[model samples]
Target: MPARTPWIRTFLCRSDNIGVLMRDPETGACAAIDVPEAAPVLAALKETGWTLTDILVTHRHADHVEGIPEVKRATGAKVTAPAKAGAAVPEVDVTVSEGDTVSVGALAGEVWETPGHCADHVSYVFAEAGVVFAGDTLFTLGCGRVLEGPPETLWRSLSRFLPLPDETQIYSGHDYVGSNARFALAADPDNARLKARAEEAQRAAAEGRFLIPSSLGEEKATNPFLRAGDPALAQGVGLAPGSEAERVFVALRAWKNRF
Candidate 1:
């Protein structure tokens, strides 16, 4: 069942990618975030019968923006993308940046610049809907590979959203939850929350399901990436019990890269 307020539809795309829709039932307006592919977005639009009013692009990766032209051509929706990333994406009618506000009918979204996976990556926070489309920067129990970094750069991006309200929910670009779970367990073997989350992800993956719409509070308690500062994690990693948070985080990222 769709939520009562802003009804969100999750579209599973090619490979493990995802495309999402946030619909305002009262206004009958829908905003599509990061078109991984057009067919799935179009299918979802048809299934929901919602009018596409806006397309918010989070990053410039081909897999994320390749379907933009097709979807915009079909719906005539206004397309918004990061100003720095506009050159790499297609049909960006409006270029936005951090603190910029975007509207989908009556709904509003705040743009957050979360680069690391790529130099031009951005994430969209639909404050009214309590959701953030983290693109490739942040995931369920993992983060994007530092394709363009010093580890600190990516760590900064991943840590930016930590201050969001506890109720904030995260929707990422791909379904890597199960594998991330395994990695988290390997690193933080004794965390009850991590163990339970790992088991849940295993069961869900076994059933061919993705664990998404992960809440910020849930992440705070279980996600090792976000818990890099925890003394327990530092001890687990043998990086000195009182190491700096950023140091612990860097070590964790290094370990994850090799994992």
Candidate 2:
């Protein structure tokens, strides 16, 4: 557990993407993980009455950085992005790499270079806070596409999360849980746990609820991409039982590409 309590607020933007506001209870310091748009982010800051202190950008995609300039103008927050991104994102006050540290008031977190979703993509994990801003690299029941790398690189990036404590909470870049759940069920049809989750995800979407903040533990069980090494997953995808983990992983990504 964190020395200071961590407060996270999740909201949607552009009808699909997930935007977040993080506050450190001890210092009243706040940060936005990725800004899909500005209206809701501004509104959340207003509602919480917390002054923004920083912008932690996960990737250089337009949807992630499109609202950065506007939000920065409004909050005057310092912006940090992947060092490799260079000029890809606007107004980077700090460019960080694999081992960089990000601080919010007295609270701090580590940078993780996750470039498979796109070259120079990154994610942040405040281990003490027990949370991660996964950006587009990972989601509830799915992961990002291989736009900039092969399945092997993505597998390595995704594998980084497996060693984290099960209690770590995941905040994703988008609200694609419903569709990911459908694809998971298709590939791993006999997974009763997945069957139950698919129905739950469908019901939640039907009721218009946000499904972005799932735990790493839940993802271990429900995300087939994460379970690609399991013999069961290999067979589910019609691979021979002893096929390599990367093979199952590559096949899974291919199936998701068409999903």
Candidate 3:
């Protein structure tokens, strides 16, 4: 029988913005996924009772990295970010690129350069934890807009994530599940999974439960951005049935931005 992997507790700061905390069970060390603001981040640290050991910045967005200095000043944790994002994130102690590994106590993660939302964007894959800090690149049932790069770049970035083990959990930088679900419904109105998910998200929000950390398998089934290659998705967007996957993806994303 395969040995059980240690379970790490994940906390959603839910600060009306984004911040995720991953704590190492053995060492009581915590890795901050993205610090949207300082106050909530500090509060999360206090609530978790875990000392901050590292900060993983997926992009140079102010909302994501603006709190680095304050958090660092308070906890003195090492900051790891993309090499190209150095100018934006001056406090990053370690510059990492695609395939580079970072560890906080017993927790380890690999950095995947995922440039599209921004040229310097990257995603951290914590294999042992079965989670990916996708920043603004990918969201629950949606994805980031092409603010800086070509649609092709965004498509490539999204594609790189598709093949991860199906059960891999995705933790995005924003809480846009309801909005994403609305767009997904417009993009594929007849999709039962999309319809059910949209309803479920509405109910969850009404009850004040955060809908996040969606699985890759679930995204593959429901996210219009990730399912752009499907013939039905192409049809919904008025693309030719035989359209290239990238073209369909680009159209779907363009539509969602306006959605």
Question: Which number leads on lDDT?
Answer: 2
Q: Local error of candidate 3 at 258, Å?
A: 2.0
Q: Backbone clashes in each candidate structure, one number apiece?
A: 0, 0, 0
Q: List, residue by residue over 1-259, the lDDT tens digit for candidate 1.
A: 1133588988698889988998877788888988989999999999988889888888888988899999999999898999988589889999998889888777777888888888888888876678888988889988888888688888898888899887888999998898789889888888998898888898888887878879888888888889998998898778888898888988888999989
RMSD of 1: 2.1
In candidate 1, position 207 carries an lDDT of 89
Q: Return whichever of 2 and 3 wins on TM-score.
A: 2
- lDDT of candidate 3 over 1-259, digit per residue (tens): 1122333334444354567888777677778887878778788778767788888888898878888899999999999889988789848889999889988777778889998999999999887678888989999889998889798998999999888888888888888898899889988888998888888899988987756778898899999999988999999889898898999998898887787
lDDT (tens digit, per residue) of candidate 2 on 143-254: 9999997878988999999999887899999999978998999888888888888888988888888667888988898899999988889997789989988899999999
What is the full ranking by lDDT, best candidate first? 2, 1, 3
Candidate 3's TM-score reads 0.94
Could you tell me the lDDT of residue 174 within candidate 3?
82
**Poorest stretch of ten by lDDT in candidate 2:** 1-10
- Per-candidate local distance difference test: 0.86, 0.89, 0.83
Model 3, stretches more than 4 Å misplaced?
1-16
